[model samples]
Target: MQIPIINRSRHPLPAYQTEHAAGLDVHANLAEPVTLKPLQRALIPTGLFMAIPVGYEMQVRPRSGLAYKHGISIVNSPGTIDADYRGELKVLLVNLSETDFVVQDGERIAQLVVARHETIAWEPAEELSETARGAGGYGSTGMQ
Candidate 1:
């Protein structure tokens, strides 16, 4: 599936790192390094714009290495870029550790996963059907 994309930054476009990879690694587009203090959050731009096909969305997710080593994570994990949005893509990053983290230009900070979504029309109903696990949530199932 080919999608229209505009790359305004000097860095290469996002690409899958390995064979059968589901997401493309996205980089930071910054003129200068940005530091995130402990527990601080910032919006890091990617300098990328794309026209996603209808019924599809771009999901922004965190890199496992960064999360494990630097305690960095996306503020909105699995951030969604709707198909109709045409603005530059920016990632909301947060430092979850006690130390500061520096974001460099062209740093691979996140992954972009293209996903297909369905739009459903709401049908008003009085009550939902019951099942064995109906209404059971949040550890309702005992942990083995």
Candidate 2:
């Protein structure tokens, strides 16, 4: 399915995907650097904004290269962008490694994947059917 994206600027920046199966890469281009110290968190902004279509949302995920190479990743991995939101896309990055990280302009900080979500109506139930491992919590099954 084709997703319509509305660029808000006359000379709007382009969003790119390296490959057909790849997620759309978002960039942040500011005059000053966006640094994250050890265990520090900050919101890095992309110079551009987008208008995502209804019935769809954008999932912001970490770039494998950045996470593995620099220990930098999105604090809220797969951050959700609701359809109703109309603002600049910002990525909340955290530095888990013991060093300062610099986010440069036009850097592919995060990947955006379009996803479809469903809203379900809840119905109250007095009792639920029992299963073989009813009420099992974490590690209920043996770990080999």
Best by TM-score: 1
Could you give candidate 2's per-residue lDDT for residues 1-144 as a string of tens digits?
665555443333545555565577777656678888999988987755666678778899998888999998999998998878878778998898999998876677888888878877998999999997778889987644
Evaluated against the true structure, the overall lDDT of model 1 is 0.96
Per-prediction TM-score to the true structure, in the order listed: 0.96, 0.84
State the lDDT of candidate 1 residue by residue for 1-144, as single tens digits.
999999999999999999999989999999999999999999999999999999999999999999999999999999999989999999999999999999999999999999999999999999999987778889987654
Off by over 4 Å in 2: 1-17, 142-144
Highest-lDDT candidate:
1
Cand. 1 TM to true fold:
0.96
Query: Which segments of model 1 are wrong by more than 4 Å?
Result: none
